[model samples]
Target: MARRIKVLQLHPDYNIKAHDFADLGEQIFRALPPARFETVNAFLRGRPTGDQPESRAERSIYFEFSDAQLKGMRIRAMWQLFRYCRSQRFDVVICNRFKPVNMMLMLNRWLKIPLCIGIAHGFGEYDRAYRRQQTARLVSPAWRFVGVSPAVRQYLLDCRCGFTERNTVAITNAIDIVQAEGLQLSRDEARSQLGLEPHVRLVGALGRLVPVKGHIHLIRAFAQIAGAHPDAQLAIIGAGREHDRLLREVELLGLQGRVHLLGFRENALRYVRAFDIWAMPSLAEGLGLALLEGMSGRLPVIASDVPAMLPLIQGAGGIAVAPADVEGLSRALDEYLSLSDEQLQMKGEQSYRYLTERHDIEVFRQQYLELIDSALSEVTL
Candidate 1:
């Protein structure tokens, strides 16, 4: 039998746990049949802390580089990685995000790896002129580009960076629905755990407390309808620098008791069932995995009109408002609040159906398998 095709999955950090956002590395590794592929995972920055889970690759390596070391020229890091790659004779390298992709581009010119695939998560990754120039100059026939969403793939094609239709494609992000559902708490249990009354009409969001998440806008929109629906409450999960600022916005709107910022709940997806409605007012997103998590919980959804989110909202029959448009968001929230229990449940079922149809994890895994097989075939030819 021929030797198994050696594969390396490179990541900038180890922050993404096994259950998060389809667990790309784990999915890709599992997609390749074990008898045909020998898979390894590498982290350029962080190491696992405490009970932090890792990718399910056959082997794992961590560089443990400092922030400063990963910056500037990254010559030292490149030398070490080159030696490692050379020693292993990897047949394929899959780099996540810009930093790993950028480094691999330069190193591969010398290593001459038969297949190098770079995955871009969102727009603006190549916004810098230098990064664009470097990518355009170093890209070769051996390389392939994957954007996490169709819009992001188009963004790559328009960047003037050597990514072409032939070399670039989209593989929309997905979540492990079965795993997420199994981990979720029941509605009443989730509500009680979140310190919410079981009977309250809850609007929920899961994301970092960052400006791009548009939590401020969501807060303002909820404030617009707060008085009308006194029984309704808004809860945002996750933590970030915008914590204090968002709190101030809540106070300014005098929505202290009605609006909550539950900073960074671990396995926060477990609490998704507590929400009567799910809102994603993001200004930008690769594919809004959190929105999928909420849909997996069978919650009625509403999101901004941003390209990344619009398709999901429309597919699920959820409302779509202009990003940062408080009036529009408030109106959408009001409509959901006005719906009777049966109507809300129907909307939620629609959302869940759309998720399974369009963003199923099995489809995602199959696509990756096909893409990899096709890429490997080209290498042999």
Candidate 2:
């Protein structure tokens, strides 16, 4: 019989933000072979009152701070992580972000199990200058560090860690594309369900409405598009602080009727199909899953020519415009609208083709399993 691999996933539930860990955790669970693994989770509830997370399902491990104090919470979290590690005998620990993981790494060095993996959800190159890894107190004891994008791994490689390209791998985020793609409903069908008219052209974006996401730039671009197409509308499907503020901008732009803010939807995946065009004008992104989700549903995408999309789109599929360039985005949208069904289909097909080759669900699942399997190979851990 094969040895069983015990895995513990850590998540900090704060405010209303459904961080990327939610998707990453669920996908990994779905990918792993149930018979070969046992799974658990540790959620940090440090902040007493901000906004509660949506819904949750319990697992083998649970730790909650249930109070508010930054320093105290960090200390309690570090303690709880060690206790969790010692208690569960986890063969592998997958840490979502840096903070708690780094803390755990330093604490675990004494009786290290040797299979610690840092699955980075945030891309570092977008922000601060690279930090000193050796001096950084919380570097994971993890054999491999998984970056959601090649850009992230390259950023680390440029940082000059001791291992010469031996420790990092770019595992692009994956969705259950088998269940998602090709089941696309007709635009008319989707519009009818969305209470939209046949003649109205809908441009949509999906993600948390935040400044970093650059949804505001997209709104600006859409305002320019709406200036001409009286019936054109923009629908944003996620909720955040920027929600009310963005709506205010729409009203100020005299687009109260044109821009629709559909706060977080239960079936947001379904909404991606309804869009005539999908826009991702983010200033920074680890990897644009929404872009792949939109493309899988056959929508022509117009993304910012940033690292995430530039590497994937390669100037094809739909349009790649300069970041914050509202005129460029508007022009791309116009060009897409001018294309005939066949021409549009050709662009949409490029998206589908790229996804099939690069972001297939199986590719992601296999890579994840292989990494965990290798990490847990030697130890009785």
Best by lDDT: 1
Worst 10 residues of 2 by lDDT: 13-22
lDDT score at residue 278, model 1, on the 0-100 scale: 98
Write model 2 residue lDDT over 215-273, tens digit each, in one string: 88878877787766776788888989998789888888888778888888765776666
lDDT of 1 by residue, 1-381 (tens): 988889999999976574755677787776789998899999998898888887788888999988888999987898999999999999999999999999999999989889999999988999999889999999999999999888889999999889999999999988889998999999999988989888889999999988899999999999999999999999999999999999999899899999988888878988999999999999998888888888999999999888777889899999999989999999999999999999999999999999999998888889888888798899862
Question: TM-scores across all candidates?
Answer: 0.98, 0.85
Q: Give the Cα-based TM-score of candidate 2 against the true structure.
A: 0.85
lDDT of 1: 0.90
Residue pairs in collision within model 2: 102-138, 116-142
Q: List CA RMSD, all candidates.
A: 1.2, 4.1
